[model samples]
Structure formats: structure tokens, C-alpha cells
Target chain A: MGIAYPIAKVKGESADRIYGVKGFPSAALVDASGRVIWSGHPSSVPRGEIEKALEGTAFLPRLEGKAYKKVDKLIVSREYGKAHAEVLKGLQKDSADETLQGAQVSIEALLEKMQGAANAAVEGQDFGVALDTYSQIEKLFKGHEAAKLAKADAKAVEKNPAAKDEIAAWKKMVKADETQFEGDFEKAGKLYAAIAKKYPETKSGERAQAFLSRHHM
Target chain B: MKLLGLALALGAVLSGPRAAKVEVGDLAPEIYGEWYLSDASSLEEVRGRVILLDFWRTW
Candidate 1:
């Protein structure tokens, strides 16, 4: 998952300060030579004003409820999309120059491959594999337009931290010992039913219902 | 205006019946073998009068 952000440059200063904007991911400042100076989470900063303080522009996209089956997946996807968008935007400015043709071609190819992977992940039903592929795509594309699409779809529902806690609890149950797992399936079934009842529009809720439909028989 | 009205009436008349009649717990048509944990052997050609269809996945 990508968490780093672009650093805003200050003239006449040796060090660049990194500040995170809420609803986006963390980032670090990179000098003209691509050297990192500082980094932190974007959520710590103010909600929507961080973009104005930057010498260069970078915006972190927020997480969405519908896409978040688990908290980690949502956070990781949003962060990666933010970082990729910043880098891709920067690459486009220099890509047209004759001297940078070779580097530009490689970057463009990587961006295409990553976009393909992300699309595949979006279509995939298996959450784990889809997330894994989407993460790789974010790394590959770095800053393509598709990254923006992904970012927009994932920007709402970061208001509550309760979902994160619920995710942690759910992860513990899924990773419990085999004996415990077997006994807990009955409990898990009820939990799934409740989730389906509460969030019927979400994929997680649909999956919970599917589990019941299959297992209860 | 009259021709447009007539066309709209014909369109509605042509395309309205679209609801499903059959649902779950209805008498299902007969299908083949059981798909579960146990494997079938060639030694005995087993057959049964009643068939139960169950859908499942191995998470």
C-alpha cells in the first residue's frame, strides 16, 4: 500500500517539510533529484485545505464504505491511489521532452500494465486477490487517470474509526484456531446475517448472504 | 400529436409482461449426481429415487 505524499518545496530552505492532508494518504517531499525529505499521514492535517499550502500540488483521496470490506484494504487502496496520482502528474510534464523520451516510454508502459491489473482487480470477486492485484497496479501506474477514478470511488466514509475496530475484531475471528473456527462458524453465520441486514448494498453484505445461502443448506 | 400518441400506446401494449412466476421450494426438475466431500467409486453403480441439490463453497 502507498502512504507517502509529495513534499511542497520552500525556496532558500535546505529541508522541505512534509504535511499530510486528511481524506488522502501520507507522503514525503522529493527534491528535484527525487530524494525524500519528510513524511506523515494526511489525516492528521486539516480536512480539505492542505492542497493550498503546497508549492507543488498533491491530494490524497479518501476511503469509501462500499469498497472497504476490511479497513486495511480501503486505507491501502486510497493511499496507493494518492501517491500514484501525484507521480503520474509530474511525469507528464517532462514526458514530451526529447531527452526524456526513453524514460517516458517506460513509465507509460508501466502505467498501462498497472491500469490493466487494476481493472482486473475491480472485476474480480475474490477480495484478497483483487486487493493484492490492485495494490500492484497502483505501484505500476504511479500517476495515471485511472488512479483518479479509483480515488473518487473511495473518498467517502472515512469519518468514523469504528469500522476500523470492527475490522480488527473480524480479522481475529477469521484467523482463530481451527477448533475455534469450526465452533465459531455458527456464530459467524449470525454475524454475516446481521451484516447483510445492515448493509445490503455492500459487497461484503452480499457475500455474507451468499455464505448463508450455501452453508445453511 | 395523434400519431405520437398512437405509437406510445402500441409500445406500451407490446412490452409489459416481464415478471418471473417460478420461485424457490417449487418442484425442481431431476438432475445428476451429488457433489460433496465424498467420492463415488466405480465398483458400485448406486442410484437413488430422491435427489437433493445443495450449493456450497469451501471459503
Candidate 2:
């Protein structure tokens, strides 16, 4: 797929979790003002709808109440980072809104909850989950104590052989993809072959083997 | 102590309100992450441009 537009690889499906994207191949059109004018399956969205949104006319009705309700729902779901992003985006439009202000309070409460969950995951020896949760916190609330703790925990987890190998393989896979994307097939092939050789049982390694077999590299 | 903290955290999440699906007319959540090309950009940077956030995963 030759996509001319800029693309981003969201680290760890955080965007999916925040946007509540249950399935892949989803599309969202954001207006100049940072409002999501339309969202749905790519095939379902009308081509004209995107054009109209870009033109700043024929927009879906603004529903502040409904937006707040959605934020509240994220709070209930313990999607603190998503809720925080929602309120922060809302604040971008109107910093003085009382409802958004109130949502901020709830966001703080949720962060505390997140910290507790991460800590619990660590105590339970669920280093993977703990590492993921901590990374989320670090992304959402940079410079916070919880983020710091998460960083420290990640370092500790890396000391474990299993965790270390998993992380290394993941990083290598990402690097391989990036190299492939940059049109350096030779370099990508080397990385993929290394992965396939080192982590033969892993899914990524399997994918690398498949890629190599397909390209006969 | 960690177990107690986890319980308390779980309690807080359970006690909080549920979030509904965000749809059209909702403020777009800011996109933050490393860019595949060039320096990373945020929703704020492209505030006035038509942004088609095409989210994908490589798994």
C-alpha cells in the first residue's frame, strides 16, 4: 500500500485502547479545530463526508453533553488515559468549561487507580502487565511519580531473562519493520533472519521466517 | 502493601463512572507517539489542517 500521507505506528496499541477501536482498519476524520468530525470503518465513511469536514461545513451536530457522557464512560471503564485525553482535547476548545474541569478531577482520581493497578501487577509477578500499565502511565502523565516508578519497574523487569529476551525481540521486530518501510530490503532481511534464528518459537520469529520465505531473501 | 494498593486502585476504578463511545462532533483525542517519518507531530501542531489519523498495527 503506497500511502502518501504521514503515518504513525502507535506504541503498544495505546491509541486503540484510548479510541476504543475494537477492530482494525478504522478511520477517523479530525477537523482543523481538533474535533473528530466523523469516525467509522473506512469503507463505511462517505468520501464526501471527509471533504465536507475538511471544508468546515456540514459537520455533525456538536454534542457537549454527549461528549461529557462519553468521558464519564471512559472513567467508569478505568480507561484513565483515554479519559484524560478526552478531557484535555475538550479543554483545548474551551479551557473554562465547568464540566471539563470536573472531568479533570475524575482523571486525577483515575490516575491514582492506575498507579495502584501497576503496583499490584508488579507485586503479583505479572511483570508484563505491570510493564505495559506503567508505560501507559508514563505516556499519559509524563514526569509523574507513577511514571518514574513504572520506569524503575521496567528496568527491574529487564533484568529477568525472559522479560529481557521478549523486549529485545520486540524491539528487533519493530526495527526490522522500520527498515523494510524505509525501502532497505537487504537490511530488513538480515534483521528478520536474525530474529527467525534467535527466537524460532516466537510469533514474530515465525512472521520473520514467513517474510524471508516469501521474498526468498 | 502492594496487594493492598492494587485492591484500593481496583476499587477506585470500579467506583468510577463508565465512559461511552466517542463519536462525531466529539473533540478528537490528541495523537501522541513517534512518527514513522520526520519529527513527531501532535494534533495541536496540525490544528488547522484536515487530519486523517490512520492507525495501524504491525503484529
TM-scores, one per candidate:
0.24, 0.38
Q: DockQ numbers for every candidate?
A: 0.01, 0.17
- Runs off by more than 4 Å, candidate 2: A1-102, A105-136, A206-217, B1-59
RMSD of each: 26.7, 18.1
Q: What is the lDDT of residue A155 in candidate 2?
A: 78
lDDT string, candidate 1, A27-120, tens digits:
2222211112223442343322222223121112232444222422422343444433433454477545432343334444545554455456
Compared with the true structure, what per-residue lDDT tens digits does model 2 show for residues A1-217?
A: 6534555545544455445565556677777545666777766766786666555421111225765887766654445556667778889999998888877775576577667877887675555556666776776565445567768777787787756555566567767865653335567779999999997765567767876775666
Interface RMSD of each candidate, angstroms, one decimal: 32.5, 18.3
Q: fnat, candidate 1?
A: 0.00
Q: What is the C-alpha lDDT of each candidate?
A: 0.32, 0.59
Q: Name the 10 consecutive residues with the lowest summed lDDT in model 2 chain A.
A: A54-63
Q: How well does chain B match by TM-score in each candidate? A: 0.21, 0.53
Instruction: Indicate the residue-level lDDT of A114 in model 1.
Output: 49
